[model samples]
Target: GESVGLHLPTLSVQEGDNSIINCAYSNSASDYFIWYKQESGKGPQFIIDIRSNMDKRQGQRVTVLLNKTVKHLSLQIAATQPGDSAVYFCAENIAGRGGADGLTFGKGTHLIIQP
Candidate 1:
């Protein structure tokens, strides 16, 4: 069963430092994972994604790590800036199931940047 309703986690980091956000999922059958960043009063934006076959994937300044063994996922942001401050979410997509239903999202994590 999925989570009914839950609050997002919170993470605080200093400017220019690296930020790491973690998430845990309950579905072991899921094979696709994505990370999104959402700013205030805005929609969530795509950051990075990884498939179950891959343990890690990297983008420009963002990296996503997937550990199916423990049903864990994480996002790493390098050289964090004030602009990077936002709420991050991890979503899981069950292979061949969510064709039209879409992905299931985690609560999310608030990333705050300190000057």
Candidate 2:
């Protein structure tokens, strides 16, 4: 009956600009967070991740920021391109829970790149 994650339905950004997607998770006990990018007809791809002990982490062109105090998380994309257009979701994993009980995912945010 409890919600695990939260997400915005859509996000629009112009080509070559930066994009920031936000998520709010309900599980304070969750220790791991991951950001995924899913293109149409394709499986979700790992973009970046952060641990509960860390507040921020960065990948090639992406950054994941976690705010445990407010159960907020965000993904930042630098110089977003049309190729970056897709649905992005945030997943939270509780420590010691694995196998069939996998990470809980957010509803996802559809990112549109305006030409």
The most accurate candidate by TM-score is 2
| Model 2 TM-score, all chains together | 0.92
TM-score of each: 0.89, 0.92
Task: TM-score for candidate 1, please give it.
Answer: 0.89
Error at 37, model 2, angstroms: 0.6
lDDT string for model 2 (1-115, tens) is 4445556799999999999999998887898888989999999898988888899999988999999999999999999999999999898889876432588888899999999
Show model 1 residue runs off by greater than 4 Å. Answer: 3-8, 97-101
Clashes of 2: 0
Query: lDDT by residue for model 1 over 1-115, one digit each (tens)?
Result: 6621124488899999998898888877788888888999999798888889999999998888888897888899999999999989888888765432478888888999999
Query: Largest lDDT belongs to which candidate?
Result: 2
Worst 10 residues of 2 by lDDT: 1-10
